[model samples]
Target: MGSDCFDESFHGYGEFWCLGDTRPYMRALGAIANLAHRLGDVDKSIAASTEALRLCHGDNMGQRFVLSSLLLKAGRFSDALSFCQVWLDPQYDGLNRPRGGCEFNPPNPELLTARLVEWHSKPWSPGNLLLNAAYAAFGLWGDCELARQYLVLGTRANPNIFVKVLARREKPDGPYSRPRTTNGTDEAHDYRWLTQDLWAEPEAWVWINTNRDVIDIVVKTCAREGCGRREMRPLDFKKCGGCRQAFYCGPECQREDWQAHRQACRQANAPPAPPDSPVYAMSGFLNDEGALDAMTLDNSDDSSDLSDLWEYGVEVEPY
Candidate 1:
């Protein structure tokens, strides 16, 4: 029962024997995937599940089912569905019907397969339903109607879990909670809060406070900024000369003053000021003059956006 005993027993087994022994490997991979998920490593979970699927090759319905589960968790609904359908199809059903063997005989492989097929067919039962819905909504996979169908089914099967999974995958970056101040007040106050100041900044702080590495933040910011759309090559922040916080599509973008990123660059390089300083005390400053100018221009074009900025600026002195 102990891990040492299992390890000792497992070591003597040959690779083909280990790979062919569906149940143990399936269980191991499933556990790995589940642990990875709980630890917030969806990519690891996906990798483990993919391995499980590969090992399940022939007739391993249990492993196949588990593979689908992990793929769903990883937001690969279409792939999960393909995996499910492969084994669940009527032609494959007999292949999955377990042959009686020593020390490991599935009680009812047909019944299990039937249950899984039914579950997967419903567009809900399996967790992948929500994943499919998300892909559908983003127009990554299918039509909105199909997405709606999956969403409805997914919600119907397990509303709370479905919603949670959808919300989590939608943000793949992580959960969305209003940031708390040191005093624990909701820190998000305005657009500036959304953009400037660590205490007030939403995305960067979300990345920093959540313990995400700098490289991860750069990758995410690039994705959000549609670097892919611009045909821009990815920038490696690790090689950056300064604060190493900001990432750009290229040297031109890095030099583009229009983005008003110098302040962020400066803050990244500048040592932390005293806690009592207005920049810290007021939460943040509008040091990005280009951003300010853009805002001013935008306000002149459309008064509504500026009204809140004007009111907030008047009520709170510039840091």
Candidate 2:
């Protein structure tokens, strides 16, 4: 959803650096697949989700989540079960650790994405997915042993999630990623607002997700209004120097659209808030009674405090 995150691309990377995928392409691919499913394009949905899974090396729960759901829908019970069980395995290690999310074990992508909004979606933990796969195994394939083992594993993983998080706190693993904010202020709320803007609306999410061409990397119409010129490449448009949020058809279109562009420029230049530090929030949750009372929470609004960090998790990937 943002510029490239590859170490190779960072010749001091920023928006202007490139308009390609940030590394770990699973999130966008998953979103595209999910959007396709919503549109009832089952074949396209599976294709997108399957491609996402193919790119994953067991690190991304989001990809696993989408692929498993699509497999079940496609009646690929064995593949679904096998995929989820691998994640459930204690030894299922990858280049990066599984994103159990800033909260909850076996992080649920749909719930995490919709946490700020009033939405009901299931989590994607190995335990939950195992149960899903088990249901399919027993019902669809008549595989009793597989179903039983999966159920056992699912239940075991479910109970131990919070415990594992607590243990993580007790035993320091390594320095975790810290939260960064613009203007040295609390950025969590701002981040939640962005995700809410992106995700809270069903149509908007689909529109944005579908429109971007990070894969095919082609565009016909200009991003600017009233400038529907054709014949495009990925880097054809000139990115606005001010906010870095938009790309002009050219210098002429940018100058011509200056009046409307001013407001956007401010927003683009404005520093986006960062999500709350995962470690800090988890620790606060564990000590909810009084431990977090002294913590300086930014009273940006009365909307939500936790949603900020939740949205931040998605913002890092922006799909």
lDDT of every predicted structure (CA atoms): 0.34, 0.39
Q: What's the TM for model 2?
A: 0.34
lDDT of 1 by residue, 83-178 (tens): 543443455433432210111112121222445435544421333323333332323343334443443443343232322221221222321133
> What is the C-alpha lDDT profile of model 2 across 1-319, one tens digit per residue?
3254333244523221123343334446656775786676766877776554443343232444445555556666555555654555444443322322111133222211223221111122334455445544544444345554443343333322212221121222221123322111122222221112222235423332343321122232454679876434433444554444355666666666666666756655555344375422422211111123222222121222222111211112212
The candidate scoring highest on lDDT is: 2
C-alpha RMSD for every candidate: 20.7, 21.1
Which pairs of residues clash in candidate 1, taking residues 3 or more apart in a chain or in different chains?
none
Worst 10 contiguous positions by lDDT, candidate 2: 282-291
Task: Provide the TM-score for each candidate, comma-separated.
Answer: 0.29, 0.34
Clashing pairs in 2: none
- Cα lDDT for residue 197, candidate 2: 25
Error at 102, model 1, angstroms: 28
Model 1 lDDT, full chain set: 0.34
Output the TM-score of candidate 1.
0.29
